[model samples]
Target: MKQYSRVTNGYTVVDDVTTRPMVRGHNFPAYSFAANFKYLYLIFATDTPRYDYATGYLSTEGKILRGLKPAR
Candidate 1:
């Protein structure tokens, strides 16, 4: 298993080893109409092997977004 450190503006991150991707998006509303709220939009962009492997449940994909907060 590999470890990583990421910084976000005002969101929260949780780790799930039993799960394949390891990280996922939660609390993000599907539709909105604000630019600043754009940060609330969670997007995952992975490459071929990386994407396949991540989707295949091998490696993990780092989470990226706005409104993220550190773990307590």
Candidate 2:
């Protein structure tokens, strides 16, 4: 496992090996959003149109819009 330090001096860095980001971008596929929301829900409306777009390396193709309700 890779680790990093949280603090650094003028010309030195202490390898604490405990301070690290909770979420790693490489853990998820490219061009996708990964997040954790306590009250958000994935809304699926058959009658409503889904929004997806891509430009360069950014995209929302495989992701769905999350909201407070299941249908919107």
Candidate 3:
């Protein structure tokens, strides 16, 4: 695997591939095994498992980041 990094607007950014997924979104057995198992809550209110840092608030994959906040 490869790695990358850059500085943007004073923030250091890196690739999401630097990490591994410990838990998967579609893992039913794992969800069944959580200590706080609540069936309705799990089905209706669970957050999608996060495998990366992308939150749609900004983009960090190019020469410059998109959707950056303006400096005051």
Candidate 4:
């Protein structure tokens, strides 16, 4: 699987791996927001008024693995 993550250094970094940001950018096709939890919140910026862009949430167990779904 193709995974994504960032180095553990920043102003809004959380101790948990999943809660920290996965990526970032400036314009369309940019990753503006990400979250790590039992459920992950990944929002892609399409720069339009259509349902506020595509999103994905991954539900996982602690330090192991769980489930996933694709963005729409």
Candidate whose lDDT is highest: 1
TM-score, cand. 4 vs. native: 0.15
Order of all candidates by TM-score, from best down to worst? Answer: 1, 2, 4, 3
lDDT of 1 at 36: 25
Whole-model Cα lDDT per candidate?
0.35, 0.29, 0.32, 0.33
Task: Mark the regions of model 3 whose C-alpha exceeds 4 Å error after superposition.
Answer: 1-37, 48-72
Residue pairs in collision within model 1: 10-67, 10-68, 11-67, 11-68, 11-69
Report the candidate with higher lDDT, 1 versus 4.
1
TM per model?
A: 0.17, 0.15, 0.14, 0.15
Return the top candidate by TM-score. Answer: 1
Model 4 steric clash pairs: 18-36, 19-36
* lDDT at position 66, candidate 4: 28
Cα lDDT tens digits for candidate 4, 1-72: 024334334223223455544444223212224223322322342354532223432323313222434549
On residues 1-72, what C-alpha lDDT tens digit does candidate 1 reach at each position?
113212353343335556765674453332322322333232333432433332333212223333444469
The collision pairs in model 2 are none
